[model samples]
Target: MFWVLLLLLAWAVAGAACTRLCLAAARAAAVGDTGAGIGSGRDLTLYEAAFLSGGPRRVADVTLVAMARQRRLLLAHTGWATVVDPRGRDEMERSVIGAIGPEGQSPIAPVRAAAATADAVRGIADRLVRAGLAVPDGAGTTIADAVRQVRLAVPVVAGLGAVALLMPAPAEMPRHLIAMWFALPLTLTLSCLAMARFEVHPYSRWASPAGQRLLGALPRHTDGAADDRTYLTCVAVRGIRAVGEPDLRAAFAHRERYLGQDDGR
Candidate 1:
């Protein structure tokens, strides 16, 4: 009977954890910004598209990659970025050039950090959010939190199973019955996880549903002058590593290393 009480307690804890995850996921989904409409007919500029698909940092990355590809900026494997043209063709390019400062050159790490936080990037994000093409910060946080909660289900179930197995058994007590009882909580946790993956995993981290649809509708280009735009789009969608140039890839990798260090602290 004592062992039964212990098992019930374990089950109760698992049930409570599963309940919390389910409720969190429900709240996240319920409050998710469905956006203005499926087709608001709003066109996305390169920077706006980047923000919708990958957020502000991606907008900065696309701007840097585009400038580097155009020979306006030089990205070295040593993590230095030097201005070659000193002239920016657009607002985003101008922001990146400005972030490099009066020296006309700077480490890619600091340049990327500054570019991401630039006023132009903030403006792009704001526009995208207002147009319903980008996820609002609060909603994104909610979905992220729910995903994290669901991820805990596995460990919670494992801990409960361990507790059940460690309980002392007396004569006439069915060990198999205890194992079967443990299955109940495990089932609950697994069900909640499956439901979340099915329901919430379709949405991208940065873009809302309308934003995703717009991203899908963006035109592809293969012409010579359009190649830079194509590459920038690819970087905005698939990330910096999609850039084929070894030196350029290294430049972004160096930036990531510093960002990782900052996150660790």
Candidate 2:
């Protein structure tokens, strides 16, 4: 039937898209695993951990949180960062301080953005990629794009099937047969999507499989001020909101909000 031809075309397109996406993801995962040396004695640094657990922004966040806790910088809940000490204790600290500029005070948002793009952060990312602890930028982008394509195609497939069933049928062509025919492709697409999610979702973001394993092995401290640095380290690797200090959490939240507005500009 004429309607059947249209439904077949839709099915072909959806099937091809799903197949391509799944194959690409599988290839990327395979390459990543080969590049990532299993049981290698290499240890993850704090900066690398931050990058793996989050990304460039997380590295900047860790640096800022460290300086704030050390009294080298002041992170106000008002969404501003102020310099308490002009001297930076390390390269990362120096980068953050430099991003804050000579005014000694600026909105935390811009500072975060600057720090994320700083040379120091790039160096860390470069080293991580070289060591195969982080995903290659291109590979990560490909995986993300593929995932998005599959997601968009799902609705298209469903719509096509619905339209095929609603179309006027000839006396000889049964609606039940049409429904069954459309269901085959729809089921195939859904199955492929589920498989891709199960296989790729874990390694879809910043860290490679090896890096994720290391992150899982990181310790979580429940003690008080004595482990404040450790706690902050956890926050950096996980997220700012994990920090229990209300004021500190507010500082990070304000920075995020300010950054969102600044980005819109």
Against the true structure, candidate 2 reaches a TM-score of: 0.85
Q: Give the top-scoring candidate (TM-score).
A: 2
* Cα deviation of 241, candidate 1, in Å: 1.9
Model 1 C-alpha lDDT versus the unseen true structure? 0.71
- Model 1 / residue 82 / CA error / Å: 0.6
Roughly what TM-score does model 1 have, to 2 decimal places? 0.80
Runs in model 2 deviating more than 4 A are 5-9, 140-145, 220-226, 256-258, 261-265
Clashes of each: 0, 0
The per-model lDDT (C-alpha) reads 0.71, 0.75
Q: Per-residue lDDT of 1-265 in model 2, one digit per residue for the tens?
A: 7777868777886777787777667656665577577424677777888887778888888888888888889999887899999898778889999999999998888898899899998898888777667777766344556666777777777788788778898898898888787777778777777877787665446676666677777765545754765786687566675667788768777765655533211
Q: Can you give the lDDT of residue 50 in candidate 1?
A: 75
